[model samples]
Target: MNDDTGGGPARGVSGGSWERATLEKLVFATLKEQRSVRRWRMFSRLLWLAVLGAIAWYFLQQQTLGAVQSTPHTAVIEIRGEIASGASASADSIVSSLKTAFEDRGAQAVVLLIDSPGGSPVQAGIINDEITRLKGLHKKKVYAVVEETCASAAYYIAAAADEIYVDKASLVGSIGVLMDGFGFTGLMEKLGIERRLMTAGENKAMLDPFSPQNPEQSAYIQNMLGEIHGQFIEVVKRGRGARLKETPDMFSGLVWSGPRAVELGLADGLGSLDTVARDVVKAEDIVDYTQRENLGSRLARQFGASVGEGFFLAAKASGVQLK
Candidate 1:
């Protein structure tokens, strides 16, 4: 009976020990898992902090670069690509760059390094007006040195320059305006697809590609374009003064070689950015004051666009209605 009692006590002690060991193991395992999770969370936080620090550093660097005041130099503002609103070569950006360059005491003269086919006339006009105003305000000379092609709206802005220099082979001129669109009414007819477009105003659907062209609307548009072309001609005449050699085809939307342009008085001389800076401006050191889209701004724009697209898709999926 004593042996049986001792065995029962021993068995109870063994079972209790096994249970305690299992409980301890489970606690350690849970602790290990928690530690791993905590470590990952900490790493993610640090990574985010590092990214933020890098972005801050980039912005600070850009500001520092912009704020740096140099010795006497030829300040250059590039009017490249299409000169339209929201573009890098937009009037707002060019005007802002011009203001900075003209305001700088170290800048002797401002140079416009132009290379563009052209874009919005309104944008070009705004830039041209601002250049003239800034020149008068600062008593500084603005030179336009054309590279490759400077036509239409590009030439409109260049007209405001004190002098226009171009390469011998560069294409210049094309001082005209145009409205372009694709007509799909015939295509729709061939496919037996009918357009059921409704508009409150008759002219609201005036230039709709899917609909038939209206003679009255076409005439009105032509007249408007002609008026704008006249305005462009006036601006060029005012800027170029007597230097412009008038021709019937000068404002007929035709491009000319650089030498031909100089001969016709569209360009003053044949020169490049380097030559203009070194010889004409007399300030060999050229400093670019062009306002470009920074990396941070680009990233933000892309992120915003992505978010907008996501919302649009979600709304479409949910069948959201808008009036």
Candidate 2:
């Protein structure tokens, strides 16, 4: 028999070569997979490091920026927007900023730049108390400058200031308390819808919109509101002292123009922030001492709440308002 026709060295050499080629291909594929995994791992690590670095930089900027100024300037804390808990004009932020501004030696005087319809009597009271305490401790003067409107709780806060300045046309003086909400009981009745509510206490669902109005509850609410209104009146009286001219409509939740407010002793005079910074404080330079939320703080606050939610909770709990 011929060697080529049978299983011989030539056929064996070809089979060995084929096996070697397959082995080499398998090794290459394994190396390639490992390289891919390593690349991905390195990329993941780099991304994580980048995130950490960004966070660190952001924090560093927040700590260092606007911390020091060479010149003596008027420190301004903005009390704009709705005054509620955790808001920019809230007691926490406003009081903290006021403390910082007062503590700063470079700041000649602290200015509260206010422009709002006002909100949250408790929050405003906290800020007002802090301002008074800080003034006594630091011996720093606080001037409230109103841009547009400083009614209700805003006036409560402004009353704590040394003096209040407003534009001629600015609306001011709604020093009162009120609780406003829509009653859906009538609407539900019109729609022939019955609300099924169950609670541990009869007063648990006291302010439930869908429920029918209870006479006892209404009287109780009115009494509570009256007490809080008395507190508000006391705060304004204490803060304003003899400056507040006692009038029937002053604390009756009536709003007034800036000129009329000055005439009624609700405001001191008509002046803008620029004029006050330049003429009153005698410091033409104005430095903002407002504790504004940075990116990190804002992101953290996103998990928190809004002003409306705070007002709702306050109303639900206290059945009172300074809005």
> Candidate 2: which stretches are off by over 4 Å?
1-63, 295-323
lDDT of 2 at 304: 38
Tens digits of per-residue lDDT for model 2, 200-224: 9879998788887889999999999
Instruction: Please name the candidate that would achieve the greatest lDDT relative to the true structure.
Output: 1
* Ten-residue region with minimum lDDT total, candidate 1: 305-314
Q: Cα lDDT for residue 58, model 1?
A: 92
Candidate 2: C-alpha lDDT: 0.84
lDDT of 1 by residue, 82-156 (tens): 999999999889999999899998899999999999999999999999999999999999999999999999999
Candidate 1 deviates by what RMSD?
6.9
Against the correct fold, how does model 1 do in TM-score?
0.80
